[model samples]
Target: MASGLLIEEGEKMRTEEEMFQMILEIAKQDERIRAVYLNGSRTNPNVKKDEYQDFDIVYVVNDVIPFLNNPEWLKKFGEIAVMQEPNSKAFGWGGDHNEQESYTWLMLFSDGNRIDLHLDIKKVALDRYLEDTLTIKLLDKDDFLPDLAKANDQFHWIQKPSQIEFHGVCNEFWWCLNNVAKGLNRHQIPYVLKMYYEIVHPQLFQLVDWSVAQKNNFQITTGLFGKYYEMLLTKERYEAYLKTYPNPNPEAIWQAIFNACYLFRELGIEIAESLGFSYNLVEDQNMQRYLTQMYKKENDK
Candidate 1:
């Protein structure tokens, strides 16, 4: 909990039951909201309990326009500190949701509770019910939402990578380092950081995911973008991963870049050996030389 949040003195966080009751009570009051269900970490049995887990709720309504028109209805939940309606055209992101079947409001209350509420028409919600394995039907006034299998994180598990995917990951990781080298040599911080984080980092993380999955028999979930990397990876490895993050200092950025390359190469070879896949040593060696030259050139000046 951040000290900056406007929580009243002696105010206590609501329990899970209280939160659920408030959610269900809200739906029960609004005749427009017919059914309610839960998604995300709240519904995943594998996820450990935490204070920050969100209530990913969906209310199956006949029409979403009425709710969209009257935004004040959200006040009934609690004293909201911040909120975002990502599906609303006026204040949204990613897509044009003018004709979309569902609308979402991501709310953060004063007491630190968050709810990612969704308003979906009955037909549209039902059509996609079976798609997500982590779903729990919370309330159904008319029994519209079907009974689902026990929620699991199987859908979120790190899958075993194919030979082609392995090759692609390795190729992309090494190939992108050249761009990082060029950007670093030119003293272009934005371009270098973008290439390092967005382009190179993803390929490295993909290899990490594959290695973790292979070691664990492809039966583990890393909890959304390696959020559980600390818990899943060895302490030394995790510490090394922490070192891969760099500040704007050129020396620190160069060190972070090298850390990422070494981590990627280490994990890449481990995965390749385990799966009997051919690892491209030549690409790795060539990229290492290229980055080293760039590093020396920049520091020598």
Candidate 2:
């Protein structure tokens, strides 16, 4: 029984207040539930509010045994369109908590609403609570949740890199670029693209974002792999990043490789400058140009 109802065109979707009220009402009836907390985007002020935001709720229960043993306890909320227990062996967690026993259930309702509910029996510690992005104490019977400051942007702070970490990131980015070159030479389009996406892109974007954060005091997300690079980068520089993508023609593979080299060199230089380290952009450019010409000549034969 699955149904998708598109809300009236331009009608306001259900609010967080409405969802929270419903969760609270359920908690009030269940005495075993000691406390309730919320996490994820709903707690992050920086994140824009929209219908897509999920209600990530947690219930601190007295004993998780009854709930964990019987699957039917979840029906009290609403008709579950589908449910996933990440902690269950079927999915992954295997009902084992090394430190303290806690169970998590992830649910999606029929009305396009979702909740990540966790039931923990242990006492809520303040230090551990603050480690995650954002959390709010919704209800407390014994009043275990700490009296902490409201959620802030500190959770996503840009950590300063050690000398070793800096070198490691540079080494990884350069080494992975070799795989992209190899894949292109062998005419393996998927392999080349995968290597670029998995290794080169993340390092390049992370470096750029880290530099921006250092300059501006680490306030923004940089939007998931420089997806919003236009907002953060100059038109010229953003255009350069865009040009890094390789054209599909086997004959044009060398051009693509050259593009990757150009983009990576630029990113590396940017990273080094931000960290006050020296970089050899000229050396990279020479090597890249030589390789591209060699590949082009070989393919032309």
lDDT per model vs. reference: 0.86, 0.69
Model 1 clash count equals 0
Tens-digit per-residue lDDT, 1-301, candidate 1: 1224656677788889999999999999889899998989988777788988999998999888888777889888888877887765665463756534788889888877999988889888988787889999988999867788899988888889888999998999899889888888898989989888898888988887888899989988888889989999999998988898899887899899889889988998899999989899999999999889888998899
lDDT of 1: 0.86
Among these predictions, the greatest lDDT belongs to: 1
TM-scores for all predictions? 0.94, 0.80
Q: Which residue ranges in model 2 land beyond 4 Å of their true spot? A: 1-13, 92-100, 124-127, 223-260, 294-298
Off by over 4 Å in 1: 1-5, 92-94, 98-100
lDDT of 2 at 59: 82
What would you estimate as the lDDT of candidate 2? Answer: 0.69
lDDT tens digits, residue span 56-114, model 2: 88888777788877767787766566777776776565756522456777777766678
Which candidate number maximizes TM-score? 1
